[model samples]
Target chain A: MNQEIRDGLRAAVPVIISAAPFGVLFGALAVDNGLSVFEAVTMSATVFAGASQMVGIELFGQSIAPWLIVFSVFAVNFRHVLYSAAIGRRMVSFTPLQKGLSFFLLTDPQFAIAEARYEAGHRLTFRWYATSGLALYVFWIAETWLGALFGRLLPDSHALGLDFLLTIYFLGLVMSFRKRALWLPVVLASSVASIIAFNVVGSPWHVSLGALAGILVAAAAPLEGVREDEANEGRADA
Target chain B: MSDGTTLLVILGAALATFATRAGGHLVLSRFRSIHPRVEAGLNAVPAAVLTTIVAPAAFNGGVAELGALAVAALASLRFGMTTLFAAGAVTLIGLRALGL
Candidate 1:
C-alpha cells in the first residue's frame, strides 16, 4: 500500500464511524419516503451529500414538486461552494481530471482534513485524496443499503447516542485547528452566529450564514501574517 | 411520484450539488492573484464552517448532549482523535442512560 493511501485510510476512520449512523438513517428514511432500495442506494452513490440527501427525502415524503426538491437540495449544499473555493488553492499538483474527480468527493470532512494537512505543510496529493474519498464513499453507500434493508431492526438511535456523534466528531475537528491564526475568534463568531441562524433562519442556511460571519471577521482582522511578510520584503530591498 | 421521476429528481440534484462544489473553484481560479484578506478568509474556512455544524447542536442539546461535548473538548486536549471521540461517545451514551 502507498504511504499516502495508508495515511488517508487512517484519516478516514473517525469520519466513517461518525457518519455511519446517518448513512443508515438516510437509507431507511428514503425507503419510508417511497423510494425503492435501488433509488436509495443510487442517491447515496450519486448525490453523496448527506444533509441535502436528507432534505431531498423529506421533501419527497411531502410529495413536493420534483424540481422544488432538487432546488432545495441545491440550496442545502451551497456551503460546498465555499469549501471548494477554499480547498482549491492547495490543489496545484492535481491534474485537471484529478481535480474534477476530487471535487466530486469533496464532502465537509474531506475538505477539513485536506486543508488541515496542507496547513501542517503536507503535500495535497491526489492519491491520498482519492483514497480517503473512496473509503468514505464506499462506507456511505453500504450503510445506506443496510439501512434500507434493515433499518427498523436497529436499536434506538437516541439511546445509543447516534444522533449526537457527529456533533462530538465535528467539535474535535474544530479543536484540532486551534493552532491556526484567528481560530478562536473565527470559532466564536461562527458559533454565536450559527446558533442565531439555526433558530431564526432554519436548517442549512445557518451553515452558510454562520461561516460567512466568521470569514468576514478573519478577512477584516489585522493582517498579522501578510504585514510581517511585506515588512521583511521592504527590509530586504533596502 | 413515479420511479422515473424519483430517478430524475435524484440525478437533477446530483448535478446541482456538483455545480456548487465545482462552482466556487471555477470562480476563484479566474482571479490572477488573490487579495491577502481573501486568503485570510479562505484560511479560516475549516474552522468557520465546521463550527457552525457543531454550535447549533451544542445549543439545542440537553444535559446528555452538552455533557458529551464538554467531555469531548477536554479529551481533545490530551488524547488522539479516536480516544477523544470514544470519550465523547461514551459520555453521551452514559449520560443518556442515566436519564440526563
Candidate 2:
C-alpha cells in the first residue's frame, strides 16, 4: 500500500472506532422506527452521515412526505458544503473524478484529520485523503449492518436505554470542537436558535437555522489578531 | 412505507449528500485562494451545528442526559473523542440502570 494511504488508514482507525456505537445506534433506530434491516444497511452504505439518516428514519416513522424527508436530509447535511469549501481550496489540482470520490466519502473525521495536516503544513495529495476517507466508509457501513442485526435481537433498544445514545453521541461530536474564545458564543448563539427552531421549524430546518447562526457569528466575530479558530479546526477530538 | 419507498428516500438522501460533498470543488476550486472569513465560518460550523443538537439535550434532559453530556464534554476536551464517547455511554447506561 502507498505509505500515505497506510498513514491515512492508521489515522482513520480512531475515528472509525469512535463511530461504531452510533452506527449501531442508527441501525437499531432504523429497524424499530420504520425501516427494514436491508433498507437500514443500504442507507448506511450510501447516506453515510448518521445524523441525517437518523432524522430521515424519524421522518419516515412519522409518515412525513418522502419529498420532505429528502429535503430535511439535505438541509441537515448542508454542512458538507462548508466542509467541501474548506478543503477544496487546499486540493485544487485534483481531477474531477478524484474530487468526486473524495467528497463522496467525506465525513467530519477525515475533514478533521485533513484540516490538522493542512494547517500544520502537510500538503496532502488526493490519494492521502481518498485512502483515509475510504477507510472510514467501510468501517461505517459494516457497523451499521451489525447494529441493525443486533438491534433486532434486542427487541427494544429503548428498554435498554439505547435511545439515549443519540444525545450521548451528540455530546462527543459537540465537545470535539477545539475550545476557543469564539467557540462559546458561536455555540451559544446556534444552540439557542436551534432550540427555538426545533419547536417551530423541526429537525432538518432547525439544523439549517443553527448552522447559519454559527456561520454568521463566526463571520463577524470580534477579535484582534487571534486566529484561534483557524489553528484549532482539526486539532480537537482526534 | 413500502420497501420501494424506503429505498427511494435513501437514494435521495445519498444523492443530496454526495452533491454537497462534491459541490465545493466543482464551484470553488477554480478560485486561487479562499477568503479568511469563509475559512473561519467553515471552521466554526461543525461545533456550532452540533451544539444546537447537544447543548439543549444536556440542559433539558434530566440526570441521564445531563450526566452523560457533562462527563462526555469534559472528557472529550481532556481525553479525546473515543474516550469521551465511552464515558458518555457508560454514564447514560449507568444512570438508566440505577433508575435515574
Candidate 3:
C-alpha cells in the first residue's frame, strides 16, 4: 500500500472502531422504524451522518411531515457547517472538485483527525483523505446491511430493548460533549425544555423546541473572561 | 409512508447535510471571522440537539432505562465511548432482566 493510503487507513481505525456500533444500530433501528433493507443501506450510503440518520429514522416512525424529518436531519447535522469552515483552510492543494468530494465525507472524526494532522504540520493530501473516508464508507454500508438482516431475524425487539438502545446511544453521544463550554447548562436547559415540550407540544416538536432553548441559552450566556475559540476542538468521534 | 417518500426524504436530507458540509467553505469563509455568540450557538448544537433526543427518552423510560442512563453518564466521566456505551447497555439489560 502507498504511504498516504496506509496512513489514512491507520487514522481511520480508531474512528471505525468507535463508529461501528452506531452504524449497525442505525441499520437495525432503521428497519425497526419501517425502512426496507435497501432504504437502510441507501441511508448509510448517502446521508452518512450517524446522528441525523437516527433522527431521520426516528421521525420516519412517528408519521411526522417529511419535510420536518428532513429539517430535523439538517438541524442535527448543522455542526458540519463549522467543520467544513474550519477544515477548508487546510486543504490548500485540493482542486475545487476534490474539495467537493472531500466535504461529502467530512464526518466528525474525519474533521478532527484531519485538523489534528494539519496542526501537526503535515500536508492534508487528497489520497490520505480519500482512503480514510472510503474505508469508513465501505464499513458503514456493510454494517448497515448486516444490522438490517439481523434486525429482521429478531423476534422481540422490546424484550431486548432495541427500542431503547438508540436512547442509550443518544445519551452516550450527549455525554461525549461534556467537556465543551456551557455543556451542563446547555444539557439541563435542553433536557428540561424537551421534557416540557414532550408533555405540552408533543413528539416531533420537542426536538426543535428543546434544541432551540439550549442553543439560545448558550448563545446568550455572558462571554466575560471566556476564551473565544475554546470551543473549537474535541474528539467529536460521533 | 411510501418507499418513494422515504427515499425522497433521505435524498433531501443528504442534500441539506451536504450543503452544510460544503457551505462553510463556500459561504462562511468569505467572512473574516464569526461572531462569538454565533460560534457559541454552533458549539452548543451537538450537545443541545442530542440532549433533546435523550431527555425525552429518559423521561418516559422505566427504572431500568433511567438506571442505565445514570450509569452511562457516570461512566462517561471516566471512560471512552465504547466502554460507556457497553456499561449502559449492560446496566439496562441487567436491570430489565431483574424486572425493573
lDDT by residue for model 3 (A53-78), tens: 98899889997999999888887787
Q: CAPRI band of model 2?
A: medium
Off by over 4 Å in 3: A1-40, A49-99, A106-136, A147-151, A227-238, B1-13
lDDT of 1 by residue, B1-100 (tens): 8889999999999999999999999999987677777888998989999999999999999999999999999999998789999999999999999999
- State residue A224's C-alpha deviation in candidate 1, in Å: 1.9
DockQ of each: 0.66, 0.54, 0.50
Q: For model 2 chain A, give the 10-residue run with minimal summed lDDT.
A: A229-238
Q: What's the iRMSD of model 3?
A: 6.4
Candidate 3: RMSD over Cα atoms?
A: 6.6
- lDDT of residue A30 for candidate 2: 87
Q: What DockQ results for candidate 2? A: 0.54
Give fnat, all candidates: 0.84, 0.69, 0.72
The digit string of per-residue lDDT tens for model 1 on A110-166 reads 998888778667899999999999999999999999999997888989999999999
Pairs of colliding residues, candidate 2: none
Off by over 4 Å in 2: A1-18, A25-39, A57-69, A92-94, A108-128, A147-150, A155-161, A164-176, A179-181, A226-238, B1-9
The TM-score values for the models, in the order shown, are: 0.96, 0.77, 0.67
DockQ: which candidate is best?
1
